[model samples]
Each structure stands twice: as C-alpha cells, then as structure tokens.
Target: MVVDVVKRCFRVFKKANESTGKILGNMIKVQELRRLWGICHMDWVTGLPPGSDKSYNACLVIVDRFSKTQIFFPCCKDDTAMDTAPLIWNRVVSWTGIFTNLISERDPTFN
Candidate 1:
C-alpha cells in the first residue's frame, strides 16, 4: 500500500520533470571533405606487467584519423607531461608534423 503510493508519486514527479525539460539541439557531424593532415586521436594503455625494460609499463598510442595509421610509444607509468611531450614530438610529430586536431577520451594528463 505505502510502497505502491510512493512508486506512483515518484512516477508523477518523473513525468513532471520530463515535461519541463528543454529539448537539445541536434549535434553537428564531421564531414570528410573538410579533413586535413595532422588530425589524430590518442589514447593511453596502462597497468600492463613490466616488460624486459622494466620501467615502461604503459603505452601512448596515437592514430591518424584519416589514414588510420597508428604509432605506439612505450612509456613509464610515472611519466609526466614534460617527459611524454618530447616522445610525441620526436617520434610521431617528426614524421607527421604538428597536429591540428587531437581527439582523445577526457584525461587529466591531456589537460
């Protein structure tokens, strides 16, 4: 009885909230015609067992969004932005040059 009443009240409250909600605008999609070089996506893989090098337990993976080519850089778990930036510059950027767009999952390190 009480549980049923509470559920009914909750449903009414939810419906009221939904009715008052604002509609969001449609999202814009990227078109390939606007594609340019140096647009890439990056991600980090961590928590792997230490390798033969012992220090490098994580990998920084960068992918060219247009070409679908990937580059992997071995890095230590404690690598700072200062430490990792040069690796990207020397190993990845040296070949592809500076990137205009870099997409990645929200990560504190990238900030």
Candidate 2:
C-alpha cells in the first residue's frame, strides 16, 4: 500500500512537470528587409579543391539578404579571425557600406 501511494505521487509529479514545461504562445520574430544589403548572410566554404593558382582553398560567401545578391571572396582554408575581418571590412564593407545585421554560421572566423 505504501508503494502504491508513492507510485501515484510520482505519476502526478511527472504529469505536472510535463504540463509546466510546455510553451504555448512564444513565436520567433522575423526580420524585415529595410534596405539593400541591410542584412548580410555570411558563411565560409572550406575544403574546396585548390584553385588553378593553388593559393586559395576556401571561399567567404557573403549574401545580401534583401536583394539576394551574392559575393564570393577566395581565401585560405586556415585563415583566422584577423585575416577574415580585414577582408570583409575592406572588400565587402567598402562596396556595400555598413550593414545593420549579419547572419553567420558562427564560425571561428567571426569570433
């Protein structure tokens, strides 16, 4: 009888926990496009076969979220954050101006 009572209490607690853990009305807020190149989607394509010059084994892909414009910058596979930031700052930022938002794959280069 003691075991049965404990089992019933455990079942009640499990049900209560299950009900309390659920989220009902939370929704993800979508970003709205406000200007050209306002939101930049950035990613790196690594492990690519060496190009004809053999200097580049990776590419930094930057896409404009608003206009769907894409830019590919050839880069080395082992480039660190220092090497990447300057390339984007000089090449991409110079061309498109400053962007408000940047979406990335959270690679080490962005760190």
Candidate 3:
C-alpha cells in the first residue's frame, strides 16, 4: 500500500513538468554559467596531520570553480574563528581574487 502511494506521488511529480530552466535561463551570464559549472561538483578533503595534536589539526581548502584552482592550508585545532578568518581571507582571497563560498563543517571548537 505504501509503495503504491509513493508510486502515485512520483507519477504526479514527474507529470508536473516543472520548468526552472526558463526562469534561470536569461539572468545567468556565460561567465557566470562557466564559473558555476567549474565549481559545481568540486570536492575537498582535509584532516589532521600525521600524529598532530587533535586540538589544532583542522585543514583549509579553497576551490575556484572558474579555474579549477585549489589551495590547502593546515591549521591548529585550537584555532578560533577570529584566527582562522584572517588566514583564510588572505590565502583564499589573494589567490582567487574573489571570496569563494566556503562550505566547512561546523567546528565544535568554534563554540
């Protein structure tokens, strides 16, 4: 019964023909589209240095979609937002000349 209900909902959703492309088509520019496509699916991996102190082993990763450029910085676990912010801004902003959107996992230490 649950499966049938789910199937019916899926059919209705598929038939809806939602057209987001039309809405987004005009506003986005070619450069903007290229930038979006460049960074749309980039992944970064950062972790502690080998046997580094747990209190200060966070990593910084910056990815630029347009150029597929990346930079990595290793920081201490005890670093605060105030400390990390400037380091990130300098390295990432200087390299990309634009502030890349950051998607860092919430650090409990920041609390």
Best by TM-score: 2
Q: lDDT per residue, candidate 1, 1-111, as tens digits?
A: 999999999999998878555886786454452344457888889998898978889999998878788888888777777887889888887878778877776667756
C-alpha lDDT of all candidate models, in order: 0.79, 0.89, 0.56
Q: What RMSD value applies to candidate 1?
A: 6.9
Clashes in model 2: which pairs?
A: none
Candidate ranking under TM-score, highest first, comes to: 2, 1, 3
TM-score per candidate, chains pooled: 0.66, 0.70, 0.44
Superposed by TM-score, candidate 1 places the C-alpha of residue 106 at a distance from the truth, in angstroms, of: 2.2
Checking candidate 3 for backbone clashes, the offending pairs are 55-77, 55-78, 56-76, 56-77, 57-77
RMSD of 2: 6.8
**Superior candidate under TM-score, 1 versus 3:** 1
**Model 2, C-alpha of 73: deviation from truth (Å):** 0.4
Candidate 2 segments exceeding 4 Å error: 1-30
1 or 2: which has the higher TM-score? 2
Residue range 1-111, candidate 3, lDDT tens digits: 999999999999987976656453444322353343234222224465644555545555665656666776776656667987788668655555543344444455456
Clash count per candidate: 0, 0, 5
